[model samples]
Target: MKKVLSIGLVRGVLGQILGTAAGIGLMTAIRTAMGLGWKAEPAAVLGAFFGVFGFLIAVGVVTDWWKWAKGEETSEAEDFQETPGTRRYFGVSLDHKVIGIQYIVTSLILMAFGGSFALAFRTELASSGMQFLTFQLFNTLVGMHGMVLIISILLGIAGMANYLVPLLVGARDMAFPRLNAFGFWIAVPGSLVLLSAILVGGFDTGWTGYPPLSLRAPLGMQMFFVGVFFNGWSSILGALNLIATILRKRAKGMGMFRMPIFVWGVLATSIIAMTATQLIGLSFQLVLFERLLGMPFFDANNGGNPILFQHLFWFYSHPAVYVFVLPGLGIISELLPVFVRKPLFGYKWVAMSSLGIALTGFLVWGHHMFTAGIEDYLRVPFMYSTLLVAVPTGVKFFSWIATLWQGRIRFPVPMLFVLGGIVVFLLGGLTGPPNGTVSTDLHLHDTYFVVGHFHDTMFGGYIFPLFAAIYYWYPKVTGRKLNETLGKLHFYLMTPAFLAMTLGQMRIGMLGMRRRIADYDPAQGFGPTQMVITIAGFLVTLSVLFLFINLIRSARRGEAAVGNIWESRSPEWAILPSPAPAHNYERDFQVVGDPYDYGLADSQFVELLPQPSSDD
Candidate 1:
């Protein structure tokens, strides 16, 4: 009992409960003393706010910073040595690798919840006539499904960046170790608050949470707002740490252009995450204030324009898609050469294309607002800018194809996911132009077509590549490879099932089916397609189950991986051993050649310096 209680996660949850009670009691007392009636909404909001800080404090993520505030000198070395074994993961530790695993584990947990929510709703949508769920419940599921998966994706990105960036750049740890741990820990309480919305009265405004609707929503809406607001800090701070690390901590001879391709992807992603995340948080906060304080920022009848809300929300929301996918795309670029046995064709172009996609992502947010009655003059420029994103995106495709041309390609499970990501993302890309075009968007807006396209992009852009990264690097993390037979089964089942689901959604959407509805007209003959989609959704879920099973069973019993399992030239695989050490690269090394020079026999990516003898 004592051992279990000592776990930081256990203590943090206890802290949150106590803090919430205190906040609610304090708010009630203050309201009663002031001759005002107690309000559940305000009290819940305050409780949630205090609960987050309490979790942080009890988890001990803030201890080092608190000590600094007292002008006390703390030993960084002692902090690392204090925690050992798996307990380090439960408690706070400054190791980037541990934090990265923590992030990934948390992401998987959230994904499970989000995916389960989706499956429940998909089942309800199968035949149509008000099956098993209330209308409000269905709407809540739809909205939560989107938002929770989105947070999961963001956490997954941070996980990959935290674990891989420092190693890729030859740094021992992040530029700000405490900041990295803090950034990750905060997301835990934020996710809890977000999930707690369902226990309270759930909101139905969809994940966008556009105003007027949100202002009138139940107290759950405020929970959504508070949750997202806190998660935004994680993105912002993690981005700052990543950018600083990339800029300041590269191995000697590693120039901006010579760094690993994945680092460039992270660098571009961090830029957007650092700057644009504030807009979404600000938009959500404004709505929260309007609900509590009766501010008229988005109240249309009270001299406030609701369209202003759309502008601020999408400014961050749309670019956030790139933030979700760029790291995955970089994973694609980084791994493709290794499997194909060729140099990354047009490496510099691929690296710059990541930046191009991020920069262009900013100008295209207006496209989402085209149907929202923005000024007529704004639509044309937004449409053009949205279409312009394809140029950089196309460059990546061209490079991928050219690199695969006449190369010795292997069909490992990781490579299969890479290929799957390309095809799915291409379908997403092909479907995007019509939505961006003003004439077609008038018909497509708010339809299941948009839903289909979005699923394609997200699955292609993040999910597939994420699986690939795990499959490829699982050995590096655990010194054991995942079961190949199970991985192949996962890919084979998920890819075709997902394709069916998205394609079915598009078909129904083209036939005038709308999004976010609990039921459809049976007279419209949409039942069969909906059934197929639901089945496909279940199949995808089953495939993921296979992956989880593989991960657990193989962690202890799988074949041991010794050295250079993929035979790649990258520093992490080539110079470092399997299951990277606490501090990476015990000896210093310098970059000596191109990162993706795969086919060349004499090319080398890095050279390790000789160690001095004891006599010296």
Candidate 2:
């Protein structure tokens, strides 16, 4: 881990410093000695390359001459030992459980950061102008928040599924554990690059990074490109790892059909992430070249069409929706069985719907650009594909409602979040059919209607379930109980506020209010909905404050929890400790019956943990 960091950090820093001197010296010597004028940019880039080479030489010398001699890698290893207060989590820990926990922690931190940006944007809106920040700053905040949350949402699913799915399917670790670590580490630096946009300048393209507009922005746009590029790499790696794991690592009895619906959703999501992420990465890299090296990919003056960037970008990004939402659907599938006290209805159908969503997701990217004036003939196929998505989505919705009806229901935080997601996602889906229609989208193309619909699907999909999943699995992760009263308080405050904020957005959109516009005349009808959304935004912000407090108060000082607090049906929950040890499952436990047999079999129980050794 230290080697990786040293290689990246020292090499970059030295390359910049020495490269600057080398270029300046060369340029001065050329003009002075030869009396010949030439361009400076090429020399500067070459110099930076030379400086980077020098750093590599230093690295080789240090490693071969000293660090590698007398077993320094082993002896000097203690130097890299984590200090008590240092960021210990940045190291490589290939344990699926550790990586899973890391993903959750990372996304949570980024979520807070993203939510803070949302608050700032809301504050600016509340003042109806420059009260908290300037116009550029507001735009930057909104854009960064959107990007951060999008990245966070994508990774958070992989993380939760990583921790839960293997155990749910009775597997030991991922199919490729080392690659899993690499997948997660990629996101760490990617997030840093994204956040750096705020310091350098700011990207106003939002996460969408629409071209022509993106090309016209400041150098900060380059930072956005770098960050997003790295994030795409992470997604690709995770998707590949997950697909491989699901295919090869299932328990003895669990086959593709027998696997839990949650795992199936992850499998579908992995496929989408694997195949779709590359287009976005390549598209963004093309934009980066155009910005940094004056490439002609999107340059209209150079005969390159900027619209091509949009086509390639949304080709991957539109499916990126399923990348985010499908995992939440998986979570809901997992939760329904536990809380509603019933086997998931139409398990086969629900599982297939996940794959259905993924396969069809690729065909719908054109829907995003209905207003961009693509070929007239192209619109109909894209519109049809876009509407085709609704069928699979609707199937999952019906399955959930069917599961909940006439069952022994428990209204816990997890169930609440799942139910909330179902309701809100339905509302979001209602707007989608409109967007699919060429005529309707022409009017609502860039309006707040788009904003409202996404928040409904995204927040309900990611944020709401995130809290629910956290609470559901808290005991297993931390070996402690979260304060129930505080958890309920957190839930009540958050859900209503989110509805207020997102629902209010729907009204603004219907009233023909445009998105990304700073302000308008106070006399217009936009004022009421604008004020309502702003006020609701603050309410949601306050709700987050309560959640943070609950997490902080619970993780450390909360009472130690017992294993299987819910008497969970799965084998992973049958451990002796609250949070299971490094390798879960005792030797005494062997496959006997299905996990959801409930109280049907007296012989279903197995001897707990610390399985017999070879000697025994």
Which candidate achieves the best lDDT against the true structure? 1
State the displacement of the C-alpha of residue 473, model 2, in Å, after optimal TM-score superposition: 0.5
TM-score of each model, in listed order: 0.99, 0.86
Model 1: lowest-lDDT 10 consecutive positions: 74-83
For model 1, how does the per-residue alpha-carbon lDDT over 1-616 read when each residue is reduced to its tens digit?
A: 9988889999898888888888888888989999998899989999998999999999988987899899988778325654778888888888999999999999999999999999999999999798799988888899899999999999999999999998898998899998999999999999999999887889999999988899988888899999989999999999999999999999999999899889999999999999999999999999988888899998889999999999999999999999998999999999999999999999999999999999999999988988899999999999999999999999999999999999999999999999999999999999999899999999999999999999999999999999999999999999999999999999999999999999999999988899998888899989999999999999999999999999999899989989999998888998888899989889889999999998898999999978878998
lDDT of 2: 0.74
Candidate 2, residues 1-616, lDDT tens digits: the string is: 6655444334434544565467557765776677766544334433433443444343232332345566654322213233222133545555678779879888888888898898778766763545657777777888998889888887788789889877776666778776776677667656766776787678677777877778778766766777788778889988888888888876665667767677888888889889889999889888877765788898888888878888898888888888888878888887777787776777788899999999998888887788887899999998998999989988888888887888888887767778877777777788778877888889888888889988987876667777778888888877887777777777787778778887787777878877876666666666777777888887777776777787788888988887577766666676446686655543444344544444344735233345567898
Off by over 4 Å in 2: 1-90, 586-616
Candidates in order have lDDT scores of: 0.93, 0.74
- Which pairs in model 2 have colliding backbones? 587-611
State residue 412's C-alpha deviation in candidate 1, in Å: 0.7
Off by over 4 Å in 1: 77-79, 612-616
